[model samples]
Target: MSEFAIHSILLGSAFSTAFFGLFAVLNAVGQIIQRVMLLRTPTWKRVYQKKQLDTRPKDAVDQLPWETWRLVAGVIGVIALLFVLWGTDYVYGSIFGLGAAYVPSFVRRQMKDNARWRLRLEVRDFVAELRLALALNVTVSQALEHIADRSGQVTTSFIERVRYHVERTLRMESPEKMLEALAEDFQSEDLRKLLVLVRAALRGGMSLAEALAQSADSISQNIVASAELSIEEMPTKLILPMLFALFPTIMLLALIPAVSMLITSLSGVPGQP
Candidate 1:
């Protein structure tokens, strides 16, 4: 019945109310997102199913759409922000929370970029191998089967998908149509060029081996040129990181001792506490 006890009870009640209110808001947002996802689920499923018929083992949790994961990340970020707000300055908490919210998306973007780079390298290898296979006078389908048997990790699934479609529609569709469709799906210029040459060969406009050899050489040269250019630009690319991250860190470290000494000196001055 004392003032301190009454203040504690009121504070506890406020904290509980705030926590529950935040939880309710987050729950409502999640439900809305879930409903939106559910409404779009059928379309997504249909598109994926139509594009890819092969069954691949995937974790149930991994199957959740990126939007759902982003939402979860955002909710976690908001909760973390609340904790930060309670424990630190509002400005720092806001900055930390905003950065945390975008972390998932940024990581996802980097992953996708890395995957694309790997796929580009894999496609170059695939083209070289296909060219070699063609030089042996094997049919395009046979060459694909040979490549699929030895494809790298990045392209194994993609090659298998292509092979599946090729075999499934062998009688009803030309390889050109299948390749064009795949090129559209992947949106790779290098792959599209290779497919275009292959299609030309399939249509009897050029010799298959000659066409593949040319495509392979062009792709190899491009890859080499890209590698050399990247090497040449490496130092330039590193300059920004040094300026933004390394320089500031070095400056901070160098200034810390000087700042501390100045502060100590000022504190030691007569009449200064």
Candidate 2:
């Protein structure tokens, strides 16, 4: 083939491949957008917003500066790989750079998970403390303040937020309103349920101490049950990784000699040689 024709054919193939890849990426992104939009009901949106709040780190001072730096680093890395190293190196570098931008988000997600589990545990402790405080004849407001002081970081932050609203708008008749608001803010089913029962019992003139004590016991039981369930499932979770890693290695070791002998026999054939 002529040099011009060969170059033209290569260019056409490259353009076609690039175009198809771009189209696929766009199609995948569109599908994700559609799926997200489909679930954009008011209730789902509220739940999503609560999740966002829970996942966001309270200590985050500023994201803009770090995000800008990441953007610049990605651009520089892509340019260096594409211009200096060329070819597949550019593809790999671009992927790595793009993926690196999402590392912070992945880290945040893991942190959020850790924080959530810790919060659940801490909340159990808070409930226990509140139960004790109520038994000691402390008021609901006083119990909250005491727990805010005594609880771990995760639960303390949550209580402090509630304390802010409570202290700001102290009402003698309906102290449970502050707790109800706290439950709404927390978006935690356990916390919400406990608060709702407390509100109902207190409103009905039931013994606050006994109600709180019951709530504490139930929350403690739930926490223990959840932990036991996780322990039970641990072995099942390990099964897949053991199959993927160990099974392949064992099979490869068993087959290597047989495969090698077959290759040797084939190579020794006159036609094969």
Candidate 3:
């Protein structure tokens, strides 16, 4: 058999072994986590059962299991590994495979970060609008309904969710508790603080409009500061990529001719076969 064919077979076998090994490890870890959860929290089994029994329609993001992205990343990594192996050598292929495996998670994290930032801005606008609505001498619920009616798409879903929970448990639960629970779902500190201020206003602890205006101003300032900090740190964030990717390529390109000349000169200098 030709050497290239042997090399291809070896690469294929190694890829298959690595892929299955990774799968087995992930599966085992998931099983362990499930078992631990079930053991430590008896309600976990009930929660899992309830989720399985629930028949509500779900979005694409909700329908997929958490590990689905990892599987997709693995597939992409395998494809990248194969392509690199065919085009180059094992070292580059391995490096690229590992990097490819992390791309899905990195992209997902970046997307979530962007969505959270947008939500924070939307919450700021919502607080400002709520203050305006309250100044019109309406009840808190009426003002919320008015704002919900006019809210942009980003805040509409959140406001609608709050309205839904409030209406669903109008007699059984306090609106403040429902609002706080919904805010906690988003897991935004700014949103939580805004909700706390709104709750305090609802209980007549402070002036609603003034508290909301202050919260809006604070959120606006925070947003501006976050933007400025991101801008200031942009070069620092870029340094690692330049060092790992661009710098190496540039250095290799710059050194190749010199290394070739040194090899040629050394070859001519002595009988160093």
- Predicted structure with the largest TM-score when compared to the true one: 3
**Which ten contiguous residues of candidate 2 have the minimum total lDDT?**
84-93
Model 1: per-residue lDDT, tens digit, 1-273? Answer: 223332332343344445544655787799899779767789878678755643442223334476665666556555654554353223233333444455556667656666666667867777778778878888777777676666535334457656555566543676666666666656778888988888788788998887878887887788788779878988997795455445334534544554455556768964334
TM-score of each: 0.59, 0.52, 0.65
Best by lDDT: 3
The whole-model C-alpha lDDT of candidate 3 against the native structure comes to: 0.64
Poorly placed runs, candidate 1 (over 4 Å): 1-65, 79-98, 149-155, 228-273
Per-residue alpha-carbon lDDT of candidate 2 for residues 1-273, written as tens digits (9 for 90 to 100): 223332332343344335444555676699899778757757877788778676433523233344454444445444533432343213323433433433444556556666667767766777777777877787887877676556435534565665565555444435577666656666677788787678768788567776777777787788789889878998997795566446434544554554455556768953333
Q: Give the range where candidate 3 is weakest over 10 consecutive residues by summed lDDT.
A: 55-64
Candidate-wise lDDT, in order: 0.61, 0.58, 0.64
TM-score of decoy 2: 0.52
Model 3 TM-score on a 0 to 1 scale: 0.65
